[model samples]
Target: MSIKGLAAKIFAKRIRKRIDTWANNPIKTQQKVFKDLLHTARDTAFGKDHCFKDIKNHKDFVKQVPIRDYEQLRPYVDRVVDGEPDILWPGKPLYFAKTSGTTSGVKYIPLTKASMPTHIKAARNAILCYIAESGKTAFVDGKMIFLQGSPELIEKNGVHVGRLSGIVAHYVPKYLQKNRMPSFETNSIDDWEKKVDAIVEETVDEDMTIISGIPPWVQMYFEKLQHKTGKQIGKLFKNFELFIYGGVNFEPYRVTFEKLIGRKVAGIELYPASEGFFAFQDKQNEKGMLLQLDSGMFYEFVKADTFFDEHPKRLTISDVEVGVNYVMLISSNAGLWAYNIGDTVQFTNTDPYRVVVSGRIKHFISAFGEHVIGKEVEQALKEGAEATGAMIKEFTVAPQINPEASELPYHEWFIEFQEEPLHIENLALQIDNSLRKQNSYYDDLIVGHILRTLKITTVPANGFNEYMKSVGKLGGQNKLPRLSNDRKIADVLTAMTTT
Candidate 1:
């Protein structure tokens, strides 16, 4: 057997035992994580400030360390950036990941020596668990292309700082390093268009067996390859068997992926962000991703509806219910104390907890008092795309609330398509129906005639791409916000596309 296949067999055995052990009693695993942190950093400033030394359980931990977002925790992070040791964790962090988000221009999230394992080990186990469940290890012996950013990092104070993907890419296994592409030189190209051209040139004829990246960027790479090779991706790399994606939900882009790959490949979903690698698709039969219970982080959830309340009730793993949208909070080894990451999620399965990312808490629209979230808009778009044989390249939704423009406020969806629908009106109907089914408030608004039916604006192809380029965010890691509560992004896009 090949070295990777042999390694996969051994790793799979370890992961299988862990899966059942952690699943059977998640509360025990969660409690263990909480206790471990309290024990290790009881002497640190944040530890003493939060009374970690006296905290006996999760309830006490919650009472002492109030929930906060990144902005609220900026003072503590500033200390870390200024070279303070034992601020959030014991000693200093190993690095900081520079994240570009919608609300914030830049967010520098710490990555401690302790928290680094949470990223690496979970990624390894995600693959090992897949191998255990599927028994498909042949691809392990072949090459896998992880499309990521440049590994070169900048020194900030005493710590290295760079994009999360770039930092992680530097740690590719030696065995896989032989096959990973494009080269560091190619990846370092700052311009997205130039970087993409380089990636296509490097991997067009390679024996690629697996590909991992954010879906939109990967789709761009595949299309470029097809155009250059004068053949489909399947023809260029017949051995390609796995499609690993995260950052953006894969549902809306599913049909586009099929067209690019030109064949079926196993899809593995991961919920990874600058803060932590939170979950992974554990079973092919399972509906949602399995949460990482013992990954050096304690998890909490505040119901999304009440997330903006004066005093929101935070629920631990033991209390979170299935089917409720929540804004997640984490107390991790990176020195963050009960920090809210802004993204929202819903528990699809409670036992052996599994979750689906609902949407960004700040990225929702309630212009007409019908709070429409990211997940609802994407689901509506997905259903619409599938029903009308439309393939979406990119999309965004914004609230149109101008009093002069109409009698009532409604949603305006700006979509760029890979394949245009036979009739866009049919696509609109499918989207409206899906939204009404998912959110009753939205349905009631339609019924009460408080808002008119939704309007779909189909932009010319590459319209969204040009906008991203103009903003210097045209790349794989960056994505267009699918929903916005305000018209900031929508107005800019509408103006650009109309011109």
Candidate 2:
């Protein structure tokens, strides 16, 4: 091993021990975080508004602060944007991570000095955990590329504002400066395809060992590189050993990615959002990411089934159970209190509090009370692809509430396949059966003759890419929704379909 690799191994050992201490005592670690966040923000405007001083425990907190999404919290966020001090956190924010919102247009999530380091540290620790567990540090000595948004920032109320990935680019550690690929100039290119082309040109011959990004964007980068070099990614970068991804499930893309790279490489899944760095896959053999209890965020969980009720019970870490779907809430040092980030997660392992993201609370199909979720669709597609040796590029599902004349309505699946299955009809049946097994409500609807088995609509090659590009969200942390109740996305896909 090189000097850097040896140093990384030693450093990783220390990080592993530190992580273990908190992971082993999750409840205590979270309680400490809860107390710290309350104490630190007690003097802020939000704290005063919410009667934070009188709040002593989790139950008191739930009573004091109601869960609010971005639109509901925009009043305080607007004040902060207008240069108000201590409106959310203490004083001014270090940065405002700008992200596109569904109904609220653009949202600026605050990043305080106290909360910013948690994001950086959590990302670093994820890699360290992998290094320590796998006893593999050689990747630390080679080139690493994180395909992300531009690093350019604009001033907003004296605070730097940009996409979270772009904002993070400013904090790349001094050690990795030499090994991180894709020059800042190249990264700054606004057009994604052009930026990716520039990245391909720069790193096609580099010793790339780690590539990190959302799966779809990274897939685009891989496709571009393959087109340019006429070689599989594994052959082009023989040293590439790891892929780090977040924002979307990676299972459905696994077969397609393996085919593109011509080999299987280790992967690390991260559960990060604009709100906070929540979790990361720690062990190669584990099924879920380790929840970060000691971070500057206190977490709460409400059963997803009851999340829409007038008063849903919020449970703390000690109260959560394995295998239950829960909507996650947070009260963090960044000034977000009882904030619903819209993610639904299931506890896979309670010993260390490991969780797998189940779906988005808002992104699901309950048009006919079937209530199918993102995880079910992704898993079903993954199983179908595996059974038929099909390589799938991307897919989405929407309810077909209205159909032509005498036919029963069914779920419509829009799929872009990298390699077509020999039996297309069999693939659809298998996927439908898999979904039926996972979601009993959907199965009951099928049995009651309220709905028919799902039908597949094959999308032309690069169809999903074109759709994203047309919507002006072709890259930079944008994820295609796996399930939608409305026909907004489905209508667009249908029009693009020739058949």
Candidate 3:
């Protein structure tokens, strides 16, 4: 074997050894994380303000610090951005990751020098974990095409502001730079359509074995490749063997991706956002990603139902229960103190502590007594696709409740299909049946006639993409809401069928 191949095997084995060690005793590993975080930032202003030196245990630490969201912490971040030293963490942050999340138009999240390890190191380990679990590393010798946003950054108050993936791209290792495709010129283009075209032109003949990105963007890249070369992606890239995706659940798009690739390839899921890298698929047999305890970030969970209450119950790793939804909170090295990142997760495993992201805390369909989540919608769509032999490209669900009417509300599903099903009504029926089987509350509501059965709206092939593009949210980790609590987005989509 080649020297490089031998080194790759050695690296994978080492990462697997570490994974096994940490997974053996999760609670102890978590406690060590908390203690280390306390000592690391004890001299910072935030630590001094919260009395971190005197707060010895979890209970005291919780009592000393209050939970906050991005808006609540904005003033302090603004001060740090304007050349203030040691306002939150030690000195200033490395850069700010800019995003347009639900509650705000543009939010700037800090990335400290201490927190940089969480972004890059955890990302590296996620790939290594997949390799260790799947036992496939031949792809390492070939190129990887990461369908990401522009790496160019804009200076905001003397600090760089751009997408987190873009920032990471700018700092890629020198050796791997040779095997990464889409030259700096193509990657630096700001337009998504033009940039994708440039990427296809640049990597059409390269030895690509891995392609990683959010699914929708990667699907678009695949379509572009087919259009240019008049060949299936499998034919065009014979060495392709691995797929990495995240930012949204992959279950709904699983069949579409398989069909596009013309075969099944090993896939890995990541749980990452601008706040922190939370988890990644660690074992091939398990569905949930192992909760990362020894990472630089410390985690806490507040029951989602009581997240907004005056006295919400905050639970540590020891208290978190399986199957219960909890809003995630963290005190990371990124100067965040019990900050609520707005995501809600449900624990699926407790021994080693694994979790699956259920949905956003503010984004849910609880307008009626029945509370449906993202997992239910994605799973139902997968079942619907199977029953009807359709390929759903994109979808969003919203409640159609009319205040003027005396009747109950019903759900409206807007779907974009790659291959149109023979019976659209049957597809809708299958999806409704699948959702009822999964959610007891929803089933009870349907049985009681409180809410009518769901209604499907067949949209143009690229309808969802067009809507996202119209709103200027076409790419890079921005997902169209699958389930909205109200009819505002539903109404907009209904009107788009006419346009």
Model 3, C-alpha of 415: deviation from truth (Å): 0.6
Instruction: Please say which candidate is ahead in TM-score: 1 or 2.
Output: 2
Model 1: CA > 4 A from native: 403-407
> CA lDDT of each candidate?
0.86, 0.92, 0.85
Specify the poorest-scoring 10-residue window by lDDT in model 3.
Answer: 1-10
Candidate 2 regions off by >4 Å? none
Which ranges in model 3 have alpha carbons more than 4 Å from their true place? 403-408
Better of 2 and 3 by lDDT: 2
State the lDDT at 465 in candidate 1.
Answer: 85
lDDT of 1 by residue, 1-499 (tens): 7876987888898877977798788999888988888889888888888888899977787789998988788888889889999888899889999987655668899999899878987777888888888888888866677778778899999899998989998877787788777898987888888898988888877888888998988888898998898887887899888888898889999998888878888988999988999999988789899999888888999999998898899889999899889999998887778889988999999877999998999888898889999899889998898889999989998888774554776788888889989998889889999999999999999999888778888888788888888877888578778888888878788887778
Error of 1 at 79 (Å): 0.7
For each of the candidates, give the backbone clash count: 0, 0, 0
- Residues forming the 10-long window of minimal summed lDDT in candidate 2: 34-43
Candidates ranked by lDDT: 2, 1, 3
- Arrange candidates by TM-score, highest first: which order? 2, 1, 3
TM-score of candidate 3 against the unseen true structure: 0.96
Give one digit per residue, the lDDT tens place, for model 2 in 1-499. 9998999999999999999999998888998999888888888999999888898988898889999999999999999999999988899999999999778999999999998999999999999999999999989989999988889999987999999999999999999999998899999999998999999999999999999999989999999999988999999999999999999999988987988899989999998888999999999998999998988999999999999999999999899999999999998878898899989999999998899999999999998999999889999998999899888999999999989998898999999998999998999999999999999999999999999999999999999989999998998888888888999999999999965
Pick the lDDT winner: 2
TM-score of each: 0.97, 0.99, 0.96
